[model samples]
Target: MQNSNLNLARKWRSKNFDQIIGQDLVVRILKNSLYLNQFFPVYLFSGQRGCGKTSTARIFATALNCEKLAEFQKNPKTEFPCFQCASCIAMQNSKHPDFIEMDAASHTGVDNVRNIIEFSTLMPVLGKKKIYLIDEAHMLSKAAFNAFLKILEEPPISVIFILATTDVEKIIDTVRSRCFQLIFSALPNDSLVDHLSKICEKENIEFERDGLELIVNESEGSARDAINLMEQVRFSAEKITKSNVQKNLGHPDDEKILMLFAKLSQKVEISNLLGYLSEISFYELSATFIWGQILKLSRVAIYLKYGVIFRTNFDLEKISEIIKIVNVKHLINVMEIFCNYEQVFAKTSNKNILLETLFFKILDHSNKIEVKTSSLIKEPEKKSSETVPWATFLQKVEALNDPLVFSVFKRAKFINAESDKVIISFFKNYEFLLSILNDTRTVWSLILEEIFKTKNLETQIVEKEKVIEQPKADIEVEIHKAEPVLEPLKKNFKSFQNSKVDVSDKDKWKLANYLLESFPGDLIEVKE
Candidate 1:
C-alpha cells in the first residue's frame, strides 16, 4: 500500500454526505437533524483518530449553510458553494468567511478562545448561517472554554458551533451539557474491507483480497488506519500482497514463530529452542504474535493428548518429540509465560530486557514437571485394584465443588486411588501424574485434603509413573448417589477411550456434574 508520492487515503477521502463509510446510523441521524431544522449547537463528535470526525463536521456545516438544495442542485452556486460553486470551493479550501474552522489544540489559550467569542458579536459576512468547526476542541484551556461557554449558552441565532475531539471526557461538563453528542465508533472489518477494495479498484491500485484482508485485520477496525496502512504499503510496492503486509507490520513472522513453537513443543532441547528463538531477532517479533504462536502450540499439545485435532503450522518432525517429552499442562504453563510477556512487551520500552527475561523464564520453566512429589518427570502406570484408604479419600475429594481445583482435575481420569495415606496417584500415565504433583504442591495438598478429606495427605509424583495395577474395569470406593443419576459419562466421553471406570448412575452423576461445572457442557440428566 505504498503511495509515497501522494496520500491515497486522502485521494479516496469522503466528500458530500453520501460518501461516508461505515457510519450509516450517525449520518442518518445528522441528516435528519439538519432536514428537520432541529439545530442543536455545541456538538461533540468523538472517537479515535481518522474516523472522519472533522470531515463530517465540515460537511454538516456546508449542508447547514447552503442556501438552497433545489436551486443549488440545479445551478449549484450559493453562499454555501454546493461544491460545484465558487463558495463551495472556498469552503473546501478553508477560505470561506462564514464557515470558520478553528483548532482548539493550538489556540488553547483564553485569549485565542476569547477572540472567537468577541468576533461572534459580528454577524456572518455573507452566508445565511455562520458555522464554527472546532477540531480537537478538547484542547481548549479551562478559562478559554469557560469564556466560550457564555457564548455557547446563548449565541446569536446565526452561529453554529461544532466541537470535535477523540477524548470526550476532556471536554468540561458545562460545554457538553449544551451540545448534542454523536459517538463515532471504530469501523467494522467487513465494512472496512469492502470500502478498501472499492477504493483500491477506483484508484487503480492493485491489491490482493487476502492481502486486503490482512490490512483490514491489522487496522483493528479503524477505517482511517486501514487506509493509512494501505497507502504506506502501496507507496513502496507496485502491488499490495499478504506477504507485504506481513513484512512491514512485523506481525511475528507467523510461520517462523510457529516453527519455533512447534519445535519447542516436541521436546526440542532447551539450548536448541534458545538458538532458534535467538535467530529471529526479538525486534522482529511483536508480543501479540508471540502470544498467539505460543498459545496455539500449547493448545495443540493439549489437544493431542485429548484425542482432539492438533492443527499446527509446523512440520511433524519439529513437534512430535516435544509433545512426547512435555505434557499438556506444562505446555500450557509455558504458553502463559509468553502471553504474560507479550503484555509486558507491549507496554514497556525496555523490550530487549523484557524479552530476554521472558526467554529465560520460558527456558527455565521448560523443565517444569507437573508431578508434585519427585524430581523424575515420568508417565504413570495403571493402578492396583485393591481398595486403598486414598481411594475413599479421592471420592470424597472429587465430590466437593472446589471449582478451580476441580476444573483442572476434571481433565484427569480416575486412574487409581493410592493405597497409602502419604501419596495419591491419578492420570493413568506415570510421567503425567508426577508432573502434576511436583509442579503444583499447594494445589496438590488443597486438592487432596480439602477435596479428598485427607488433611494430612502428602503427594509423591513418580515418572514413567507406574501403571494402574488393577483388573479391567474395577471400581474402588464408589459413591452411590442418594438419587439415581443419568449416564452423562457413557453419553459423552469418547476422549477417555482408555478409561476403565464404570458408567453407572453415581459415576455418571459425578462425571456429569464435574463436566457441567468445569467445562461448558450441554449435558442433561433425567434422574426420575
Candidate 2:
C-alpha cells in the first residue's frame, strides 16, 4: 500500500543530477567524470546537514550502473540514469542488489564494518557495478574505520565505495587522502526560493513570495529543512502568508521588528518599549532570534544610509527615515553594543530583564548627544577681573616661601570668585601644572581659607582659550619688515667668517673691536 503522509523533503528528493538544486558545480564535475568513465575506488562527500550530500551520493551511484549510460554519454550530456531500465527501476524501489546503503551511526562496531568489507569483493548481481553508500561515516569507531581502511584504499574493480559525512575532520586523514573529495554546500537563497516556488506550483499550494522568503531564511540554506518547514506551514494554514507563517512558526513578523527599531530610533522611553514588547510573547520567541533580527536590520540600515539596499522585506522609505534620524555612527554604536551583550542573552535565565536593560542601553546610544570633554580639558570660565575675588592670593602664596605653589598660581589668570570657591584659567602650555596644583589643593586649603577668610575653599582649574593664529598676510608683512634688520647681520657674519684674524691674547682685542664695529650690539664681555 502507498503511504499517504510522505513529507515534502522525502517525496521531493533528487533522483538525478539535473534535479538537484544549488549544487551546479558538483553536478558538472560528476557528469564529466561519468562521461570519461573515470571512476575512483573511493569517493568522499562532505558538508553540513540537509545540503544534498547523501542524495548526490545516491544519484552518482545509480548513474554509474545505469544501463543507458553509454547512450547518455555519447551526446556530451549528463549521465543521468534512464529510469525505464530494469536497473534504474530496482534503484528507485530501493531493491537494487548491487547498491548497498548503510548508516554508520547505527552500525559503528567493527563487526558491522566486516560485513561491508565482505561485500566489497562480490560482483554485481543486478547492475554493471557494485556500490556501497555509507552515511554519517564519521560515527564509525576507530576499530571499524581501521578495519575498513585497507579495503577502502584497494577495493574490487567492480565495486565502488562512497562515504558521506557532515564533519570530514572526524574522518582519519589516511581515509581522506585516499579518496576523491566532493564538497556539498548549502543552497543559495535565490535558488532555494526558486525551488520552493516550483514545488508550491506543482503541489497546488498557495504561497506569497515574502512567506517563502521567511522559510528560506529560517532554513539557513538547507533545502530539506526549507521544504519541511514549508510543508508544516501548508498543513497548519490554508494560505501561506507572512502572518500565517509567523503564527505557525512563532517567529516575529518583519513589521513588528521594524516598528520596534523605529521606536528605538525615536528615543522612546524604556517603559513604552517594554509595554509595547508585552504584546509579544517572549515564551514563543528566543532572545537570540530577536537580537539576530535587530542586528540584520541595523546592517541593512547602515547600508541604506549610503544608498545601498539589500534583498529585505523592510520598506525602503521606512529604513531611510530611520537612517536619517540615526546616522551610521549611531547605528554602528547600537550594533557594537548589541554584539557586546549577545552572549549574555543566551546565558541569562531572566531574559526579560536583560532584554529590557538592553533596550534601554540601545535607546541611550541611538541618538546623538554632545558629551563634555574630560576633566583635563575643561572649558575655561569667562574672564572678568571685577567679578573675581582674592586678588592678593598670588602675593599670599608667594609669601608662603613655597616656590611650587607660587609658580602654579603665578601662571593662572583669575576668572571668577564665589563665596567659597575660586576659578582660574591656565595657558595651554601650563596645562600640565593643573594636575600638580589639584593634588596639593587639600594640603593648602587651610592657607587658602585664611587668605580668603572663608571657612572652606574650592579651587576650579580650566584651560585658557586657544590663541588665534596670526593671519598669513600679516605674518608675511612682519617677515618683510624683519628682513632689513637680519640682512645686515647676515652680511657682517659672512664677512667675519671670510676674514683671517690672529687669536693671540693681545690680538683678541682686535676681533672684539671688529665685532663691535660690525654689529650694532654692545660687547659686554671679552672671552680669551
Candidate 3:
C-alpha cells in the first residue's frame, strides 16, 4: 500500500544521478568526474526551482563517500554509491555526520559563515569526504559572503562545498570564481509528463492523458509542482478527467476560452460578448488568467499562420477559426493591448468591467485591420510611412515670419493631432496667445490650413486655469491672516496630474499613428 501521508514530490525525489530528470549534461559531467576521480573543492549549481540541484548534490556526496567505490567503478553500468554502502545508507537516512545541508535563507549572517568555516576545518568523521550543501546561497549577506571568500579560495582537500541558488548572479564574483559551475534547466513538458506518468503508475493513480497534460501545463516545467498537482487531482476523483481537473483547479475550460476568442474575433456585440464572458465566470477565471489565455491563443495563431505547428492541447480548429478572421497583426495588437493593461487587470477589483473594457478595446483594434475573408491568406503588409516630425504646426507658424504669433504659439503644448483636428493646450499664463488668435482667427486658421492641406485639419485650443484647490487654511492662518505656503504644493500636484494624463494620451496617439501607417487608408480613430 502507498504511504498516504507522504507527498509525491518528496517520496519520488531522485535518489541517484541516474534517477535525475532532464539534466543530462550535468549528470554526464558529474559521472565522468567521479569515474576519473577528479573532485573540485567547491561546486556551484544554479537553475529554477525543482530542477534537481539539491538531489544531485546529495547523490554526488553519497558517491564520494561510498565504501564500495572501487567495486562500483569496475562496473560502469552500476548506479552511483550502489545504495548499499554504510555511508550511502547514512546519507539516505540523514544520519551521516560528514554530510551537512544548510538553508542559507535562515542562516544568512557572518556568524553562520564562521560556524560553517569552523566545521569545514574538521576532518571527515564518518566518510571519506565531508560535504556541505548550502541551498538558496544567494540569500547570504555581503559580510557572510566576504567571510566565505578565504575558505572558498583555499578549502581543505577533504571538504567539498555545493552551493545551489535559483539566482546565480546574486553570488559574489570572488566566491563564484572559486567554484565549478553547473546550470540546471526546468524540465521540458514531455520529460515532466513522462516522469509524472511513471509516478502515477507506481502509485496506482488513474488519470486521463489530457488531464495529466493539463497538470503539466499548470506546473510550468517544475517537476515538483507537477507531481504535487497530480497528487491533488488524484484526491479529487478516482479517475482524473479534463472537467475534473478544470473544476478542481478553477481553470476556465480551454474550449470556453477558445470560443470566447472566436466570438471576439468576429466582433460580436459587447452585450452579447459580456454575456458569454459571464457564463465563464470572469471572477473565477479572473482578468489576469484570461489575459494569459489571450497571449497563448495569440501565439498559437501566429505559429499556425506561419505553417509552424507546435504541440498544443488547445483546440486547433477553434484557433484556426480565429486565425481566419484575424491575421497575425490583429492578434499582435490584441496581445499588446493586454500587455499595456496587465497591471490594471491585476489590481482592479471590478475585473468583469475591466475585462469587458478590454474586449471592446480589442474589437476596436481588430476592426482597423482589413482581414482577408479566405482561409490561410493574409493581407499584404503596407509600406511604412516616414517618421512624422513633431511640432510641425509651430514650424508652419514660424514660417509666417510673425514674431509675436511665433513666440506665443511656440509655448503651446501639442495635446493631439488628427486628420480631422489638431488640439493644443495653453496654460493660464499664456492666455495672451488665445486672445491674440481670437482677435485674428483668419491668420491662425491660415497657418494650420496650409500645414494640413491634405488632412484638412481644424485647430482647437484648450485653456488651463491655474485655479488650485488647497486644503482649508489651518485655523491659525485664518485667525492671524498668515501667508499660506500651500500654493506651490497645489501647483505641483496639478502639474503631476496633467503630466500623467499627457503621457497616457501620448501613447494612444502613437498606437493610432502606427495603425494608420500600417493600414494606409483605414480610418483609425482615437477615443478618450
Candidate 4:
C-alpha cells in the first residue's frame, strides 16, 4: 500500500509502462524490447526533469527482476510487472537490495563509482538480475566515469545499468557511445491536464478547469511540476480556483492580463496604463509572466488571422475583439519586440518602470504602424518625377572620379526629396562621412541638379540621433589624474656646455650664420 501522506507527485508516479503519460512511442519500443527479452545491459535515459526517465528506469528494473515476469510472458495477457510479486513490491517500496540506486550528484567521486563497480561484481542476492539506477549521471566526475567505464563495458551476466540524466551533452562521449540511448520528451499540455484531472478525481479534490489550465501553463510541460503546483494550491485553499492558482503562483489574474492586452490593442495612454499597473501588486505581476501572456495572445491572434485553428482557452468574443484590432503582421511585430526585451526585463532592477516603458513602446509602435497603414490606404499616388531613384544616383556617384565621396554616399540613406533640397541621413557613427560630404555639398548639389534637370537643388546631410546609456551608480570607475613631470634642466644644460663650439656643430653653425646674416658683423672672440 502507498503512503497516504506522500506528496501528490510521489504518490502518483507511474509504476508501470502503461501508466506513463505523453511518451507513447518510447513506451512502445521499451515494451516490445521487454516482451522479447532483447533488452541491452547498459541503457541511457535522458531528457528534461520529471519526464519519466527515473520512473521508466525503475519500472524496467522491476519488470526485469519480477518473479512473475516469466508467468506473464507465457500467458501474453499482461506485459507489465505483476505488482503482487516480492520483487515488484520491494521495488515499489524502494527496499529491494538488488535494485540499487545512486545519485551521481552527491557521489561524484571515483571512490563512489568504485563502490558500484565492486557491487556489480557480486551476484544478485534475491532476484535474477541486479539493476543499478544512477540519476543525474552527467554530474559524475571524469575520473569516476573512467572508473565505471570498464565495468559498464563488460559487466556481470546478471547486472544491468541504467543511467538517467537531464543533460546528456555533459556526459562523456565514450560513456554515451557504450550505452543504448533513449530520449524522453516533455508532456503536452492536454495530456498533462488530463493526468492532473485524473489525480484530482482520485484524491477527491475539487478543481476548476481554468485553474488546472493555469497550473499546466506554469509547469512548462513538466508533469512533476504540474502535480507539485496542484498539491500546493490544494493545501492553500479548500477548492482550487483560478484566482487561488494565480495567487499561489505569484502571477497576476488572467483577466487583468487580458485587459492589458485589450488596452494595448486600443492604444491606451501610457500614464493611464501605468496608473492601472500601479494599482496592482508588482510582486504578483512578474515581467516574465506578463510577457508570456502577451506572447500567447499575440500568437493566438496571428493564428486566427492566418486561418489557423488555435485554442487560447480565453473567451471567443475576447479573442475576436483582439484579432479585429491587430493583424497578423502587427502581432508578429509585437511578439518580436517582447522577445528581444525578455532578457532586459528579467535583469532590470526596476521592473515596474521597465514594464511601463515597454507598454509605451508597444503603443507607440502600434500607433505608427496604424497611421502609416491608414495613410497608405488614403493617400493618392505621386508623379514619377517627385520620387528620386537614390540607387541610380549612388551608381552614378560611384562611376565618378571621387571614390571616397561615393563610399560615404553608400552608407547614407535617402530621406526625401524637396522642391529645393534632397535630404539624406547618416548614422551617428558615420558623422565624419557626413561632415566630409557636407564640405563638398555644392558638388553633390550641382550633380543632382544636372541629373534631375533642375536648378537650386541643395544637398543636405543629417546625422541620426542615438540613445546613450547613463553610467550605473553601482559601478566603481577609477579615473586616473594625469600629473605633468618637470625634470631638472641642469643635465641638459651641462651637456650643451660640454659640446664643441666649432662651426662643425650644427647648432653653433646655425647661430653663427644667423649672426652674420642678421647683424652683418664678424665675430672677433667667442665665449664658451
Point to the candidate with the largest TM-score: 2
Quality of model 2 by C-alpha lDDT: 0.80
**Worst 10-residue lDDT window, candidate 3:** 494-503
> After superposition, which runs of candidate 1 have C-alpha atoms over 4 Å from their true positions?
1-6, 70-82, 250-252, 264-267, 283-335, 338-348, 363-528
Residue 86 Cα positional deviation in candidate 3, in Å, after optimal superposition: 1.0
TM-score-best of 2 and 3: 2
Please give, for residues 15-55, the per-residue lDDT of candidate 1 as tens digits. Answer: 77777877788888887676566788677899888777888
| lDDT (10s digit) by residue, model 3, range 1-528 | 354666888889999887899999999999888887888999999999888999989999999999877766677677567778789888878899999999999999999999999989999998989999999999999999999999988999999999999999999999999999999998988888888889888998887888888988887878888888787888878887778888788878887888888876666777788788778677666666677787888788888888888668888876886778676777787777778788887898887688878789877633553443643345775433311333566777787866656776677765555677666667755554565566556666776766654334334545665655545542223246778666444443332222122323534555344334445554423433
Sort by TM-score, best first: what order?
Answer: 2, 4, 3, 1
lDDT of 4 by residue, 1-528 (tens): 557978888899898888999989888788777667787889999999889999998988898888877776667567568888888888878899999999999999999988888878899987999999999999999999888888888889999999999999999999998899999999999999999999999999999988899889888889999999999999999888889998898887767888888777667677777777777765456777777788888787777777787877666567777668665666776787787778888898987678777678877843433332432144775546544566667767877866556777888766677666666666766655555565567656666776654444334445666666546663456789999999877754432234334444544465465445545655554335
Which runs of model 4 end up more than 4 angstroms from their true locations?
327-329, 365-528
Over the full model, what C-alpha lDDT does candidate 3 score relative to the true structure? 0.79
Error of 4 at 264 (Å): 1.9
RMSD of each: 20.0, 16.4, 17.3, 13.6
Pitting candidate 1 against candidate 4, the one with the higher TM-score is 4
* Each prediction's TM-score versus the true structure: 0.61, 0.70, 0.68, 0.69
- Candidate 1: residue 322 lDDT (0-100): 54
